[model samples]
Target: MNRRLLLLVPLVSALSFAAVTRVEITERGDVLQGAAFGPAGAYERVAGKVYFAVDPKLAPNRIIADIDLAPRNAEGKVEFSADLYMLRPREAAKGNGTALVEISNRGGKGLLGMFDLAAGSSDPRAPADFGDDFLLEQGFTLVWIGWEFDVPPGPRLMHLYAPVATDNGKPITGLVRSEWEGDKRVTTISLGDRNQVAYPLADPNAPENRMYVRDTVAGERRTIARDKWTFSDATHVTMESGFEPGKIYEVVYQAKDPVLAGLGPAAVRDLASYLKFGGAETPLSDEQKTTKRALAFGVSQSGRFLRTFLYDGFNQDEKNRRVFDGVWAHVAGAGRGSFNARFAQPSRDGHPFLNVAYPVDLAPFTDDDGLLKKAAQANVVPKIFYSNGSYEYWGRSASLIHTTQDGKQDAAIARDTRIYFFAGSQHGNGSIPPRSVEAQNQASVNDYRDSMRALLVAMQAWLKDGTEPPTSEYPRIGKDQLVAASALAFPKLADLHLPRIKREAYRLDFSVEPPRVGAAFPTLVPQVDLDGNETSGIKMPEIAVPLASNTGWNLRSKTIGAPDELYSMVGSWIPFPVNRTERENRRDPRMSIEERYKSKRDYLELITAAAQKLVSRGLLLDRDVAKLRDRAAKEWEYALKLN
Candidate 1:
C-alpha cells in the first residue's frame, strides 16, 4: 500500500463519528387563516372535533392536532389522526401569535380547518349557508382565519373540521396568516394553490384571480380585488398593508393584463409610484401614478411603512417573469418602505459545480438574479433572498456553495444573509424524484442529505459570524484522497467579468486576466515481485546526486500527485528561472502517467550509463549518484520485504 494511504485510513476511522449528536425540544404552535376570497363575514370553518395534543415520539417536542373525521357515508363516523406540528415564534416581542403549520403530506394536503379560540366563539358556519355565492363562485375552498381577542401567552386549544369529500381529492394549499396587536398590526401570510376537484364550475385558477384586504382598526373584512384573467401570475407575494395613526386608507391592486393583477387598493398608490419614478421603462398609467403617490403620502403621514417585491425564474415565460417581478417589487418595496438593488455572480472554476444531476451554473441569468440586482440598485437589500434551481429537476447542492461564496464577495451587501436549501429538495420541492427500488434504502440518500445540511450550516455560520468558508470538497481517485480539495487554480477569469455599458458590451480587458504556466511531473518507481505484478508495496524514486542538490524532493507532492490536475506526470522536472527577456523560453508540458512509465526503461538506461562513466573515471566517491541510487534501491528492497 502507498505510505500515505496507510497513514490516512487509521485517522479517518478515528474521526468518522466525532460530531454526531441527539437532542430534543418541545414543538411550537403555528397560526392558520381562512382563504382570502369568499363571502362577507367569512371565517375559516372546521368540522369534527379538533384538539391540540403533544407527542412524545417526535423529537424537539411536537404539538399536533388530533382530528376525528367521521365515516364518509355516515354522519358522525369519526376518523381520527394527527395532522401537523406547530412551531415556536422566533421573538416574544412579536408575540406568540405567529405559528408554522407543518404541511401534511409535504404540503400536498390542504388545511383542514381553523378555530378562533381567542374570539370566544364555537359557532360553526359553512360556505354554502353564508349569503355569499362569491366564495363558491370564486372557488375559495380554504380561508386563513385569525382572532381579535388576546389569549394569554402559553399553550392554547382550538377546534376545526374538514369536509368529508375534500379529503378524497387533492389536498388544499394556501398561506398561514398571523396577526399582531395595535392599529399598525403586522399580518403575515403564506400563499400557494391546490386543486381538490376534477372540474369546478368556477375557473380552476380562481386562487390566482383574487386578493384579500383586512381593516386593522375595525378587524373587519374590506374588499376582494378580482383579476380580469382566470389565473393569478404572482407567487410568494408579500405586502405590508395596514393603517397609520391619523390616516384612514386602504391598499389595493388592479388587474393589468387579463392574466396579471395590479396591487390591491391599499397598496395601489405606492405600486403606482414604483411603476413611475422607479426608473422602470414600462411605466404605469397616469391613474396608477396618481394612486401610488396618494398612498405614499398617506404612508408618510401615518408614520407607517410599506414595500413589495417579486421572485421568479428568469428563464420563465413573460407571464411568469411579470408575476415574479411584481411580487418581488411588492414585498421588497413594502417591507423596506424604500427600494434597493444588488448583483452577484457565483461560478466555480471549470464548471465543476455543474454536475449532470444538478446544474446551478445558469442561475445568474434568472429572474431571481435580476430582481436581486434591481433591489440592490434601489438600495433595498431584502431580508430574504430567493433563488431557484438552474436545471428543471435537480438539486443545487454544488452551485449553492459557490453562489454563497460569490455572495460573500459581493461588495454591495450591507447585512448578514441566510440561505435555505430545502431537503428531498429537487427544484424547490415541487419536482419529485421517481421512486426506484434502490431509493428505498436510506443509505442511498444519506450522501445528498448530509451534503445539503453541511452546506446550510456553513452558510449560517458565514452569515452569523464573519468567517469565510473553506472550499467544498468531493470524493474521488483513492481512499487517501477521498475528499479532493477544490481551489480556484485557473488564473484567468474568462467566466468572471464586470457588466458593461450599452455599445461596448462586447469588449473585454485581457490585461486583468491572471497568467498560466506549465507544471512539473513527479517520478514514480513501482515495486514488484518476481511475477511482475504490482504488489502492495511502493517507495520513493532514487535521487540523482547533482539533481538532488539543485532540487530537493517535495514530500507532499511525492506522496500524492499535484493537487491541481493541470499537470500530467509525477516527478518530471521543469526548467527554473527562465529568462524573461526571451520570448521562446517556455518548457514543455509534463508527460502523461502512461508515457512516464513507458520512458522508465530508458531512464534506467541513462542512470546505468552515468554510474558506469563515474566508475571508469575513478570518480565514484561518497557523493556519487551510484551510491544514492543504491540507497534508494535498498529502501525499495526493504519496503517490499515480505514476512
Candidate 2:
C-alpha cells in the first residue's frame, strides 16, 4: 500500500479560508548560526502568532458546554479568541502532508525540553524551543497553541483572551477562592496560585472580600478580618500576617469578568479545522498537499485537554467535519481537562490540595455515549491513541476510564482507541534517555520516546492506510494485575515515606452553574502488583528486568504545599541491592539484582528478550531496541562496579 494512497480524502471541501497569517522568520540553512539546526535545507524556521475568532452560532453548545450553567455572555455573543505558532517544511514536495499539533504543557517546559532537544542542542534553557529533530525528521508540520487562558505569559507561550459572562452587560461578581502554600513569612502574595491571574474586585477593601488560614485540608477555616487583606493591586491581594511554610492560606474575594471559559473548546476546534482544511481568515501555505491532515499530540496537562476537547465534542468543526484525524494523549491518566465553565481552572489538575474533581475524566471511555448524545456527532468520533504511565494509575484515575464506574469489571475499549500503559514510569519522567550513574536518587529511567514515535507511525498508518494498530496494552481489573494500593506488597525501603492516600476522583457538587464550585464525594485508585509496580501494562526493560522498584507516586515537597502527601506529577525511584543476601539483610521483601540475573551478560540477555517481546507485540519499536540493549549493558557495568 502506498503511503499517499492510504490517506482518505478530506471530509470537507478545501477552501482558501486561511484563518492565519504566515510570517516566514528564518530558514534552517540561513543565518541560524553554528550548524544551527540540523536541517537538510528543506524547511524554514518560521515564527508567527495565528489568531482566530469563533462564531457563537457555529458553536451552539460551547456557550453552555457540558455544564448546565447560565450563559455568561449576556449578549449571547462571545469574543472568544486564541493564538498558535508553527514550523513547517519550506516546499510542499519536501515533506509529508501531516501536521502534529502539540497541546502546550505548562508552556512547554519539563519533559520534551530536556529529553528531546532540537538539532545541535539549540536554545539550551528552560522552555526548550526545539525537539530531537524527531518531528522535523519525519517532515511533519509541527505546531503549538495557547489553549490555557490562565497561564502566565512567557517565551513561545500560547494564550487565550476571552470575554466574561455578563448579565445585561453588568459585571457578574461571585465568591472566587484561591489557595497557596509558602514557607517564609511573606507579608504579600498573589491572589491566585502559580502566577495565575486572579479575578479583579469592584473594590479591594470591600466587606465581601475575605481570607482564611489552615495547616491541613481538614483544618478549621478561621476567618481573617477585612483589614488583614487589602487589594494592594488590581488582581493581587496582600496579607499583613505572614504565611508560614507547609500551611495553606485561602482567599475568597469578589471578582468580575468571567470569560465564557467554555469557549476554550471551540478555540481548539476552530484552529485545528483552519489548519487542516484551510479556511483561516489570513494568508496560508500554498502547499495544500502537505496540509491536508491533522494529528494532535499532548502530554500531561495538554493530554488532559485532548480528553476534554473530545468530551465536549469539539473534534467536529463548524462544518460538521473532523478537526483531527487522530489524537495522541500522553500521561493524561483517566482525567479530562478542567476546561469550560465560569472561572474554570484549566491547570488545577487532580491533586488533593489543588482543585478537587469538577466533572472531569467522567463518563465511560468506550463511547461518545455520555459526553455527546447527538446522533450525528456520535458517528464522527476520530481515531485516538492514549498513552499513560504508572503515575496516572497512582495519581490520576487511570482504571476508572477502562473499568466499570465502580472500578471492578474491565470496560471494552472502542476499536478506534488504544489505551497504552507505560509501566513504572512517572507522570513525565524528565527524560527519554537511558539511566545515568551520577544520580543516586533518580527517577525511573524508563524511556517512552522511541515507543511513542513508533506508535505514532502506527497511528498514522491506521488513520491514513486503513490498517489496525496493536490492541490496547494496559493493566486489567479482571486479572490480579490491577489491585488496590492497600494491597501492594512492596519491599520495605528504609526512610522512604510511603503515601497512605493517593489522588482520588470525586463527584463534586456544581450546584451553581455560573460558578461551578463544589463539595466532594468518595474517591478511587488503581490496584498494583506485589513488587509495588503496576503490572499487565506495557513494560519497559527497567520494569521487566530487576534493578530498582520504580513507582509513579512521590512524596510532596515538605518545604511547600501539603507536607508528606503525594506530590504532583512526579514518581519515586527506589533501587535494590546486588544480591538476595544483601536484600534479606535490609529486610527487603523483593529480590536483589543478583538473584534476578546471574551475571552482567545475564541481565543484558534478559533486557534483550524483554525488548524483543515488547517490539513483537508493537509495545516497543524495533528502532528503539539498540538503545535498550545499550542501556542494559550500561546497567550491568554499574551493577558489577557497585557490587
Candidate 3:
C-alpha cells in the first residue's frame, strides 16, 4: 500500500458490517420484473441504494489517487464516500449467510450476477436480468458495487462516484494517450466507447494534438494533421476524413485531472470487511452479524479486480483483518485490472488499436506472491480458485499467472490456489444451442456449467471443512502444454482464420511514485494438440471425445476489425460434418464426425465414459454425470435427427 494509504488504516474506526441508509431504487418490488425473470421461489426482491460515509483521514487514499483526469476535491480531510446498489431476498430467512459480491464489468455489467446467479441474463449492455434461481436456490445474498470510475450513469447500471486528485485548488495536468480503431467512416469518436468522457485536449487546436493511423496493428503508420481531427466536445474528437475499417488511430495530448481511481479496490475491500465483520450504522441482522466467512467471485473484468485487490494489500482491512476468506477469479488469466493509475481506464482490455500500454498482467500469479505482496497474515492466505478459459491462454496473458517469468518454467502454484482450464471452451461460452450456424463462428461443445456448478460446491466445502478440492488443471509448462499461439496449427476450415494477434504479457514496471503506463514484457501462450484443443487442463467429455475443433483463439467477425486477429474473448467451435465424404472433399486434415464415431450410440458411449473419468478424478460431480450424458444424447439426437 502507498504511504498515504497506510496512515488512513490506523485512524479508521473499527467497523465490521456495512451500515446502509437504504434509499429505495425501484417502484416495483422485483428489479427483474416479477419472479419470472428474477430470483425464483417465494423470494421477493427489494432493492435499495446503500449509502455510507468514510472519514477522509482514513479514506483519503482514494481521494489523492496518482492519476491524470481525476476530478478536483480540494479539501484534504472531508468524508470521502460512495453508494452500493443491492438486490436481496426481502425476507432474511430466504438467503443463506453467504454473500456473493459482483464487480461490475465495463458498461456497468454484472457478468456473474446476471449470467450465473440469475442464469438467463445475457445482455451485458443492459440489465434485463433473469435467472434460473441459482443463487436463490442456494440462498446466497447477491451484492454489487460500482468500482470503476468511468461507467456512465444509467438506470439499472452499477457505478461509483470517486473524488479526483488535485494539486492545491488547480486541476493537475499530465500527458494522456487516447487510441481507437473502427471498421467504419465515423464523423467523430469519444475517448471511450460506452462512456463519453473524453480526455480534455491540453490545447484544442495545438499542432501537437497529433493523430496517427495504421492499416494493421503493426502495419504502416502515417500522421494526420491536427485539423483533420478536432475536439468537437469535452472529450469527443471528430474526424474530417472519416476512419477507415481495419485501421488503428491514436492521439497523444495533455489531459487534466486524475481521480483517486485506487478507491475502487478500497471500496471492494472495505465493503467486504464491513459486511463480514459489522459496520457501525449497518442494520446487521442477528444472522448477518454472525457472518463468519465471506467469499467473493468475479468474472472476467471483475475477476481481474479481485486479483488486483489482493495485490494492492486491500485484503487486509482497516482493522488489519482479512477481507475475503476465499476468492474465485473466473477467466481472469494472468492479468490484474489496469486500476489505480494516472488516467487509468479499468475497462481497457489491451486491444491493439486502443489501450495497448495500460498496466496489466503484472506479478503475483499466486495468492502469496507477485508485484504486490500482502501484509503478513495471522491465518493462511485466502484460498483462491483461478478459473480460466481458452481466451486467457490465447490473448489475456493467463500464461503469466501459471508459468515462470521467463516462460521457460512453471511457477509453483500455492497449495491453496487451484487453477482450472475449461478445456475446448471460449472465454464466455458455457454451452451452445442444439444446432449452431457454421457462419456464426459459434464455440465448440463444452458444457462447463456442470463443472462450474461442481466447482462452486467444492469451493464452499473447501472453505468450510478444509476439504481438498480438485487439484489444479491447467496447461503446465513442465508438461510442455504451455506454448506460443504460433506453436500450434489447426485444420484448414475455410470459415475460420487462425489467430494472428497473439497479445502475450511482459515483465511490467509500474513501480514509479505516480506509476507509469505502457507495458512490453516477455510473455508466452499455451500450446495445443493436433485437434487444436489444449493438451492439458480439465478436458470436458465433449473435448476428450471430440466432435468439433475447439480452441481458445477465434477470429473477429467480418463486421469488426481484422478478421484474422482473434476476436475479443469469444472462441471458435467448428464441427465436423456427419459424412466423411464431405470432409474429404474439403481436404480437411482432421477426421469427419462419421470417421470419429460409428454411430450416435458410439458417441454417447464415449461421452458417458469420459464424464465418468472426470467424476472419478473429482474434476466433476456425480450429479453432473447425468447432465453431461443428457447433453451428449441431445447432440447425438440432433445429428441423427437430420438424417
Candidate 4:
C-alpha cells in the first residue's frame, strides 16, 4: 500500500506544476505598470510555461523577463516558453526577433546560464565571466552595474556586454545581446557607489573654461581662455595688460571655482575683500577689515584673470581723477566722444537759467565730489543749478550749474548751463512749491511751477536731439529776474559777512551759532512790475480759508477801500523783511516798531474759530490754529518792544 501511495504522489505533484502560468506587463507614461504573484499561496500553482503581453502604445522593441524560483529547484530543471502579440492590433504575428533567457538558482547559488533564440531555434551561449573583463579593457573600473547608450542618427546595430558567474565558468552577456540604431559607442562602467563614478563628459576636450573681466573704473576689459593645461596648479596664472603709467585703473575678474579643488582659503579671503571696499584707505574695524580683505582678493583675482586693472581705491578724489583720465583716454582712442557727460558751472551767469530752480538743497542726495569729477571726465554736464530762497531752510539751496567747455579741465561751464532760483521757496520744496503760508504763497508757487516746467521742456529738447532753447521767460520785475543773493537764500554757502573757507582746507575752525529768533530775512523784494513800471501796492498776508466752507478772505488778492498811503504800512508790517535794504538794515531792533504792533493785532483777528476749522481740514489734522496765531502775536509784540 505504501509503494502505491508514493507513485501516486509523484504523479500528482508533476501534474500540478506542469500547467502554464500567465504574466502581464503594462507601461504607462514614465511609470512602470504590472502585477506579480501574491506572497500567499496564489503562485504555488505556477508551471513551466509563461506568457506576457506588451501595451501596443509602449512601442517597445525588446522585453526583459525576470524569473524567480524555489531553492529546491535544480539547474536546468525548469523549462519555459513565451509568445508575444499586440492585443489592440488583434494580430496573430507581426514580426520576429531574438529572445535572451538567463537562469540561476533562487538564491543565486547555481551557475548562471543563458540561451539565445533566433528563427525559432534555441541555442545555449557561454557562461558569464562575472568579473566583467570586457568593461576593464575599455578603461572602465566597474563600480556598479548599469548601462547607458546614445541613440545613433540612423538605425544601427549594437550590443550590451557584461559578464556573469556560471557553474561551469564565466561567460559574457554580449554573446546573445543585440540592438538596432548604431551611434558613437561610449561605454560607462558604473561603480558600486554612484558618487564615486567619473563620467567622460567631464573630459577637458568637452568644453574649455573661459571668462571675461570688465574694469569699470579704467573702462577696460579682456577675455581669458582656459583648458586642462591652462588651469593646472600654477597653470591658471592671471596677468594684467594695456595699463597706462600714472593712470589709476579699476580691474574686475570673474571665474567659476570648484568646491573641492579651486582657490585656497587665503586666496578666497583676499578676493572677498577686494570686492567689498574697493580698496578704500579709511581705517576699517576688525570685522570690516576681514570682510574687505576677502572681497579684495576675489576682485583682484578676477581682474587679473580678465586682464582688467584693479578698480580698488579708484573712487577717491585724486585716484578717481586718474582713473577717469585713463578711462576717457581709452574712450577717445576708440573714437567715442560721448562716452561720458558730466560738467561743472562756475558762476550764475556762466550757467543755463533753466537749472536754477532745482534748489542747491538737493546736493546732499548727489554723488560725492570725487564721483562727480569722474562723471565730468566721462562727459556728464549739468543742465541746471537751482538755489532756494533763504538760509533758515535746507542746506542744498545754493548749487551752481554749469556745462563743460569744448575741451578744458575745470574751465567755467558754457552759457548753455542753466541757473534758476526758487523765489520764496526753500530747498526741494521748490520742485513743488506750496501755495500755503506754511510753504510759499500762491502767486510765488504759480510762478515757480510755470518756470520749472518751461525749463524742463527746454532741457529735454536740448538733450534728446540737440535743439537749442530760446531765452528763458523767468518771472521778472522790470528787466531783472529774482535771484538768491546771500546765505539767507542759499544756506549751504556762508553768509557774505562770514569769512570764506578755501576748498583745499581740511578743517574748519570757526564757531557756528544757531540763527537767533527774528533774525533778519534775506532776498530783495521787487519794487516794479514786469513791464518795468514803478508801482505802489499793498502786500497782504496769506490767509487760511475754512475747510468746510470756501468763504473767507483771500489774503493774496489786492484789498480795496483802504487808504493808498496806508499801502506802505501793509508792506512794512510783513514778519519777514520785504526789501533787500530793509533786510540788511533790520538787524537793528527799532526800525519798524509801529508796524510790528499793528501786525500782531491783525494776526489775532485773522486766526478766528472759523479760520481754524477750515485750516484743520486742509492740513489733515484737527489742531488749535490759535497756537500759531498766539505765537506770532508774542513774537510781533516782542519785536515792537525791542529797543
lDDT of each: 0.21, 0.63, 0.63, 0.20
The model with the greater TM-score, 1 or 4, is 1
Q: What TM-score does prediction 4 earn?
A: 0.20
Runs in model 1 deviating more than 4 A are: 1-86, 89-369, 382-444, 469-643
Q: Which tens-of-lDDT digit does each residue in 1-643 have in candidate 1? A: 9843443343223211111011111222222233333222222322211111212133211111111211222332222211112211112122111111211211121122211111112222333223222212222222111110111122222212222222334332322211111122233321211111111112334343344333322224444344311222232223344222211122112211110011111122222222223323333322123211111111110101112222211111111111111111100100111111100000110111111111112223222434355445434332332221111111111222222223222112213232221111122111011112211111111011112223322333343353543232211122221111122121121222111100000112222111111221111111222211112211112222111111100111112221121111001111111122221233212222223333434545555565554344332322344443554343233222310
TM-score of each: 0.21, 0.84, 0.84, 0.20
Tens-digit lDDT track of model 3 for 452-563: 8678778878877899999888888677777665666555666556666776454444443112434444455656666666778888888888777777666656676566
Model 4 RMSD, rounded to 1 decimal: 37.0
What value does the lDDT take at residue 304 in candidate 2? 83
Tell me the lDDT of candidate 2: 0.63
**lDDT at position 56, candidate 3:** 44
**Model 2 worst lDDT window (10 residues):** 3-12
Worst 10 residues of 4 by lDDT: 330-339
Tens-digit lDDT track of model 4 for 190-257:
11011111111122232333333332211243444442122222112222332222121111112111
> Number of the top candidate by TM-score?
3
